[model samples]
Target: MWLPNKNEKKKSIASIANDFIGDGEAIFCDSSTTCMHLVPYLIKKQNLIIITNGLHIATSLSERSDAKIYICGGHIYNSSGSVLGSSASEFISNFRADIAFISCEGISKNGIYMSNDEQAQIKEKIITQARETILLCDSSKVNKESYYKLCGYNNIDTIITDKKPEKNSFLVNTDIELLYPVE
Candidate 1:
């Protein structure tokens, strides 16, 4: 029951993401609100190549002359400002990214999960094209279950969150590196 305040958790996520990202990296970012917090940090990187399905994320970084933004073309979800479908997936396959940043609705011993099947599929494809996949999750979503399984902990190289999971929680049994805001 370690539910965290939304704004506080978002602040934590932003701090942690800033530390993990570096300059001149090719990145894949999913269309999740949590990932949106990464926009300001990404703008600071030099020669950053970002490929994303999040329209809002692309637009936010669009003004950064230091970065290159590529938005995937596919079915658009007006509510989430996300594009996902076969076309988007195919577009993603053309590039090999240094890292993929994704978010999930829930995390459990079984695997990471998403509420939307299309988003889950898109995340799956992103994972395949990146050398490393990082999941951005808040404490509130831990231990919760969702409708579609995106992948297992094995697929994620690291997880950045607002708080570290409980010792007895399923995450402790996995090898994924867990990061949280420190100052």
Candidate 2:
């Protein structure tokens, strides 16, 4: 499992969410704190609903009267600070989101990667139910592989990062739009 440098990770996630999401649309995001930060900015309208499993995120958004927050309940991984289980998967499967914003521990030339099987399963459901799936990751995660494969590069609609890869990098062939943060 690859752990990205904390600072770069947030910039990468923010750039990705800002580039892909549009105004007034619902988005499903991961429980990662870095990914959650994108919510306040990406959501342009007061009516935008945020779906997530992160308690911190739910609590923060609860104070925002403009947004409606839905919590996905299930088994909790205390170490990872995230939730995953059959119930969470079922809830995600029923949700039809305009975009599902996700964060992974690593990525390879092949595709998005995860360190846990249960998390991967939940992500799979989120991807299938949403119209578009965007990944928020830093460049340090590039070319790294993990135990569970979430999807290939082609499966990702867009990737947001702090830096751009080489022109011939593996992601180029997959045609996943790469967005870098504005300096």
Candidate 3:
């Protein structure tokens, strides 16, 4: 697994929130640690509602007064601290949002990819159901492929990362907007 360094992960997620989301937009954010870092920014918006599936998000958003949180029911993936399964996929398929912020274990020129099959299916559903999809990842994940393909590069509206893509050859032709942290 290509795990991002702490600062890189935070920068990646913050860039995703700044670029794809607008004021008053309801967004569905995955319960990944990277996604959690972006939650404070989303909560600052008076009209943003966050729909998520993990207990961590619920606890994190509990003290926030500006954002409203909704939990989705599903089986938990203990290793990742995420919810996934058929029921989770169905719930994701039925739910629609202005944007969905997703984080994957890996991604390649071929497509958005994931490490787990059930989580991959849920990610695919989120991509289909949301009007716009923003992928949050770090430099380490770029150009690195995974087993299961969630969707192709065309499916995502934007990709946010901490490192500059110029250093990674494969990121050149994808046509996805790339966001880097401000120095």
Name the candidate that leads on lDDT.
1
State every prediction's TM-score relative to the real structure: 0.93, 0.87, 0.87
> Residue 113 lDDT in model 3?
81
Writing each residue's lDDT as its tens digit, candidate 3 over 1-183 gives: 223346755755585566566777778888777887775666567777777765576566766646777767788888556787787777767678999888888877677788778877777877888888888887778777778888888888887887666754666676787676665
Superposed model 3: Cα runs more than 4 Å off? 1-8
Per-residue error for 151 in candidate 1, Å, reads 0.4
- For residues 26-110, what per-residue lDDT tens digits would candidate 1 score against the true structure? 9999988888878768877899999999988888888654688899999998678899999999999999999999999998889
Between candidates 2 and 3, name the one with more favorable TM-score. Answer: 2
lDDT for position 112 in model 2: 86
> lDDT, candidate 1, residue 73?
97
Worst 10 residues of 2 by lDDT: 1-10
* Distance from true location, Cα of 183 in model 1, Å: 7.8
* Backbone clashes counted, model 2: 0
Q: Which lDDT value does model 2 have at 118?
A: 87
- Residue 19 CA displacement from its true place in model 2, Å: 4.0
